[model samples]
Target: MTDQFLHDLLGRMTTDEKVAQLMQLATPFFKGASNSGEITGPMVNMNVTDETVENTGSVLGAWGAKEIKAIQERHLQENRLGIPLLMMADVIHGYRTIFPVPLAIGSSWDLELAEKSAQIAAKEAAVSGIHVTFAPMVDLVRDPRWGRVMESTGEDPYLNGAFARVQVEGFQGDDLKNNTDTLASCVKHFAAYGAAEGGRDYNTVNMSERDLREYYLPAYKAALEAGSEMVMTAFNTVDGIPATGNKTLMRDLLREEWGFDGVLISDWGAVKELIPHGVAANEKEAAEKAIKAGLDIEMMTTTYASHLKELIEEEKVDASLLDEAVLRVLELKQKLGLFENPYRGADEEREKEVIRCDEHRQTAQDLAAKSAVLLKNDNVLPLKKEQKIALIGPFAEGNDILGPWSFLGSTDDAITVKAGIEQKLNKEVIAAKGSDIETGEDDDLQKAIKLAGEAEVVVLALGEASEMSGEAGSRTNIQLPAPQLKLVEEIVKIGKPTVAVLFNGRPLDLHGVIDKTDAVLEAWFPGTEGGAAIADLLYGEVNPSGKLTMSFPDNVGQVPVYYNHFNTGRPKGAPDAQIRYVSQYLDSPNAPMFPFGYGLSYTTYAYDQFSLSRETLKKGETLTAQVNVSNTGKVAGEEIVQLYIQDKVGEIVRPLKELKGFEKIHLEPGETKTVQFTITEEQLRYHHADLSYTSDPGEFVVFVGPNSAEVEAQSFELE
Candidate 1:
């Protein structure tokens, strides 16, 4: 359909019909008349009726070819204009073949793998009739206390922006209109949802516009630039206005400034939430504000359905705004080819053939392997196949490895760590649940200790339960659960060689576990093939290369610790210097337990011979920074050579260092590789005090290394 056709269709739609196009409801609402659909929970008072459901333009949280086809067929039958219902779902990581959570994927630092995971998710979801996935959630998160941090790529704006673009490309492909395997991408939480106050979920976000642009908004802009078909408003308020109804953010910045003409939908219940957010008094006011603010759709609520028509009739909202919103919806449907076929990619047989196929599962396995971060090692990794081993923990044989937001993945199909290791080793292994994820009795600890005493080495499978880390899963104590810690303390006292294999979603304070374990592997929710990937790394079948995207605090008290923090007036003194009035913690070190970009491999790489192509850089000039990286250890490995830059002086204080570029390289023993980074003038620009983005003429420091904490430095001048 062309623009003219969409406009003509919109012209034909009644005020009621147009209002319905802006309303999205769940599957239960469309379960037929005999079903006598009843509202429950939050919907009981929402005033949604069967008639409203009949006219709704979109359906969410519904999938499977048969079910979606039935819904579409039924919706089209009742819809006044026969506008096909847009089907959407949360296909975050994978559909059936689950991959690592977004945080784990970010650790891989491999955009190709990240893009492939999104592509696989699209392929599986498209066959199931999902038109859009609320994914590539590119919120840049620094605090792990926010449960949804698991949904985002880590703290860096640049890295998150890079992943956002590639992931969107993977989901939509080059031609979303023609591709049967692709689903339209909806980059979410439009503005700074991750910076919820005090790292709490769905809380207020108050930051300077400069802070919002400098640190948070880049990823969303990048995704939109990459052609995401839609954007979802966040649940939080920006400044004092809720994002769903923040006109300055939604209209001035997103639509007028950024030129995002795609449909903008409110996050689940966000528009109605404007009442609770103190911005609107009732559903009528909420509906008026959201539409005027440029929100095209209201998800999971009846604010628009209940009051949008009346609001338009009263001229509270311009009729043209409603038409424009409806136009965007119809345009999306036309782009998805739903206008031609109501059941666009809904094929039951195709869904069966594509869901969790061997090829897709293999990709999941490979990504899972690349995502597990080696946090600590003491020659205990690559466990000898012949050694007597004890795999002890709740997750040792548990199938709950799939992290949150993996709505389509089945735990029954997930491979357990016990299962993966059994296939790798012929020797009999002692496996026991050392403790429950959050609870452990004396007997459980005794059994774990007995198993450890009998085995030559102990592999302690530990970490939070899958429920502890997604949405609404914030933690004040970002450490292992108490019972699990007790179990670890007892097992480590047995004095056998121990390897701690952690499965979690967020970065944890691992001071206790790291000290007692000979080796620690952060296998963050590795999905369906997680167990197998862990086994591969344990037996030397694969070398771990994942780096930490989020920094690990030394304690929960250091909640917002990140590597790119600005220097204070009174910086910390030297390690051996007396701590008097300097900015140092009284009881803890100022540094993080595990810095960003920190990871260990089975073998080591050495960095040296750092050089710059020029001592001075002029405006519009690009400087090449080169460093020689060598595999100095005995075994083959992969290294993420990171490049960071620092402005020596600025109008506004700059961070100590900012990650600008990185390269993941694989090398054989004794192999030498020269890693070169071309730094452009654009990379030096930052939001000034007045919020103008520009670079100052001054000296700059360039650092290159394996991680943010340890790096070799050089200096250059920008003219």
Candidate 2:
């Protein structure tokens, strides 16, 4: 439908009905009939009876196919105008067949796989009648101590952008109306929720405009470009105002400038919490303020349902704004084909067939293998066939293998590391619990140590628990939790060679363990097939190609650190540099423990001299930036050849380097390949003070490397 048709429909809506369109409740995917209304979380009320399904909004709990259909039917048959309620649930990693968390997927750095994951998720969700998903959270997280980092794609803006695009495409699909399996992708947390102060979840995000525009906005912009249907406002405040009511962010940047035509929904109860943000007089005022700021939908907040119409009648809010907000929502529903067939996706059989099928499981396994980042390999990994190995850690054998937001997923279905190792090994393997995840007890540690001492090889299965790095799981200290590190130290004390297989959701501060362990595998929370994939890499069945998505800081003080830092005039001069003068720390170096894009492989690779097609290029012209990479080691491996560009001189001092493009490739032993990146003037463009995007004519530096830190640079001029 065109704007004219949408306007006519908007003009026909009653004030109460328009308010109803803006209100969304927490309804689960599964459908149910409740004689008595139910209260959930702090704010949701679901009134489901034999006759009518009436409530502020509904929350989808652990409902399966039959239940999902049954509940949606009630909403269609009973609600006023038979306008079906918006269905939602935490479809985090996977609905049926779980995959690794966002952190694990980030390690892969393969946006295609990320996109595929989203597509499958959309397929399953659409089949189940879920109209929207709270995902593609494009928050640029700098602090690893924030637990929700596990749910993000990592700390680099470029990689996050690539991943966000794939996810957006996956959720929304190419065509929303035709793809019944496609649900509207809700790009989340409007602005800067990840830079929570002190790496704590729900803390204030105080960042400069230069930093926010240059770094954080890129991912959200990429998501929008990928066709996201909605955006969920974050819970945290940017500078001073909470995201739910931040006009500059929601209106000036997102709507007016970016021209986003999607519905803006609040993060659960974020609108009412404006009172906590001290921005609103009460919940009613909060509702008025959020809607006025261009927020189109109130998720689980009855404020819009109960207070918006009153605010309009009292002359506290404009009717046009409310109409515009409702129109956006109606436009989305119309685009989703909900207006034509409200029950188009309410098929029970299709939902069952799509959920947890073999195709989804296979994809999960492939992603699990791809997401495993090899941090260190000291010529001891890819263990020999007859080797006696000992696997140790609380996570080594448990079912709590899936990471956070894994709602209704079966832990019992998970394939443990021990099981995988045992199945693959011809010889006997001993496995023991090293220590409790949160606590550092000795009984388990002693047993683990004993097994390590006897075995020729020790595979220490370690890292944070499933809950340690997602949502409310933030921690100030990111070190390997206690006695587990001590257990590693004890096992290291022995003469036997050891490899550490870590399962974590965030970048951990492993200062002491870095050099001690012979090989370190950052396994992340690889889903049900995690064990099989780890074993495959352990025995050289698969080479480790994954790289670190987030920069691993050496210590807690350098919380917000990355590889693309600007050099100050007062540079740190080696270790002898005075700490008072530069960005250097008193106790540590200015570098991260593990830089962004840092990862190791069993096979060696060499970066040859970079060759450019032309050193000087005119406007609208292209430059072919090429580099020859050779696999020098015995076994075949894959490498992510990264290309970065630096603006040598600009009106504003640009970043030292920015990732331009990258390619992931597989090469056999001694195989050489010349990889090329097509660079255009668009690559040099930056957001100006006026928010206009344009490239300045100047000299540029192109750097090609295995990772951000180890790069070879060349210069060019753009006239």
Predicted model with the maximum lDDT: 1
Q: Write model 1 residue lDDT over 431-533, tens digit each, in one string.
A: 9997888888888889889999999999999988888999999888888998888888899999999999999999998877999889999999999999889
Q: Please, what is the TM-score per model?
A: 0.98, 0.94
What are the per-residue Cα lDDT tens digits for candidate 2 across 1-719?
A: 57687788777767877877776654441235342144545634423232222532334342454555666676666565655556666677776677899888988988888888888877776777777788878788888889999888887788888888888888888788877888788887789898888888888988877678888889999999988888889888886889999998898889998999798988877898899889999888898789878998776666877688899999999899988887787788778787677655767877777887888877987898889988888889889878888888877786577898776567888878988888788445678888878787777778888888889988888888888879899888788877778888888998788888888888988876777899899988998778878888899999889988888888888877887777676777746666587767788777898888888888989999698889897888999999999999999999999999999878777888888899999999999999999999988988777656788887999999998889999888999
In candidate 1, the residue pairs with backbone N, CA or C atoms under 3 Å apart (3 or more residues apart, or in different chains) clash, namely: none
RMSD of 2: 2.7
What is the lDDT of every predicted structure here? 0.90, 0.81
Regions of model 2 farther than 4 Å from truth: 1-12, 28-41, 44-62, 426-428, 574-580
Reference-based TM-score, model 2: 0.94
lDDT of 1: 0.90
Question: Which candidate leads in TM-score?
Answer: 1
